[model samples]
Target: MEIKIDDLQGSGIIRLLEEHLADMHATSPAESVHALDVKALQHPSITFWSAAEGNSVLGCVALKSLSCDHGEIKSMRTSGAARNRGVATKLLNHLIADAKSRGFKQLSLETGTQAFFSAAHGLYAKHGFVDCEPFGDYQPDPNSKFMTLVLEQ
Candidate 1:
């Protein structure tokens, strides 16, 4: 699969992001559902990416600049049809690589504390991310688990 920057306009990506937000709301309280919709991901401070093969959009991820040397991972989701095919991992690796290339000193993310997020927690841990205090605009929330990977920049 190819991973590249996306403009968040394709039909496939729009549908996938909608599904992502729907699941987020279903799994967490409204106030805690931080998943971005298509419009939100298009912000100038955020860079969005799509992983696809030919005409099929397999997954997508975004990085939001929280500071000159820090970025927050946002809106990471794999298409329902593409789960377990390593889509999330590829997108994450791409995001991490981009962060390093941009001279970011750290990459952080906020995910749910629910059982539905167990796999995500494992994925981040496997990639050397450790639990951390909330960063950026986030505050302590019982439903949120924050993780960070400090890049050797």
Candidate 2:
């Protein structure tokens, strides 16, 4: 799989992001769904990436800069056909390394507490992320689980 920065203009990526938003809404209430739209992903503070094989998009992830020493993970999704193939894992590892290289002291993310997101929680835990209080503009919500990994400088 070839993973690289994406412009968020390709139809494939647009469609995938739409699907991601749809899934988030389906899994959580509208107010609880923090997944960003494609337009939001294009903001100057966000870096987007796509994983592909040949011309087929396999997965995508984005890293959003929260501060000089902090970053947030966003828009992590793997194609339905590519689940369990390490697509999200590779994208996450790539983002973590990039965050460290960029001098970020912490990487944080928010996910759902539902069973639908249990795998995600497990994945983050496997990567050494520990539970944390809400960060950024987030508030305490029973439906939301926050995790963070502190990077060694």
Candidate 3:
């Protein structure tokens, strides 16, 4: 699979992101949903990428700078047809490597506390993310679960 920075203008990625947003909204209330929209993901502090094979998009992930030494994972999603093929794993590993290369000392993420998010939670834990209090601009929310991994320099 080819993974590279995304332009956010591709129809395939746009559709995938829309579906992801709709799914999140349906599973959680608006107040508890923190997923960024297309516009928000395009901010200067955020770097987005897509995994693809030929013309088919496989998965996508984003890293958002929280501070000079910290970053947050955002909008991680794998296409339905691409599930179970290690696409999400590859994208995640890529993001982690990118963070390290950029001199980030830590990486963090916030995911839902619902069944729909169990797999994601497990994935993060497998990669060394430990439970943590809300970071950055986040406040404590019962519906949210935050995790962080301190990168070795």
Q: TM per model?
A: 0.97, 0.98, 0.98
In candidate 3, which residue pairs clash? none
- Model 2: residues with Cα > 4 Å off, grouped in runs: none
Candidate 1 backbone collisions, by pair = none
In TM-score terms, candidate 1 sits at 0.97
Residue-level lDDT tens digits of model 1 in 66-151: 99999999998898799999999999999999999999999999999999999899999999999999988889999999999999
Model 2 worst lDDT run, 10 consecutive residues: 8-17
After TM-score superposition, the amount by which residue 17's alpha carbon in candidate 2 deviates from its true location, in angstroms, is: 0.6
lDDT against the true structure, per candidate, is 0.93, 0.95, 0.94
Which is superior by TM-score, 1 or 3? 3
Instruction: Evaluate model 3: give its TM-score.
Output: 0.98
Q: Which residue pairs overlap in candidate 2's backbone?
A: none
Residues 57-153, model 3: lDDT tens digits: 8989999999999999999999999998998889999999999999999999999998999989989998899999999989999889999999987
Question: At residue 32, what lDDT does model 2 achieve?
Answer: 91
lDDT of 1: 0.93
Compose the digit string of candidate 2's lDDT tens values, residues 24-123: 9999988899999988999999999999998789999999999999999999999998999999899999999999999999999999999999989989
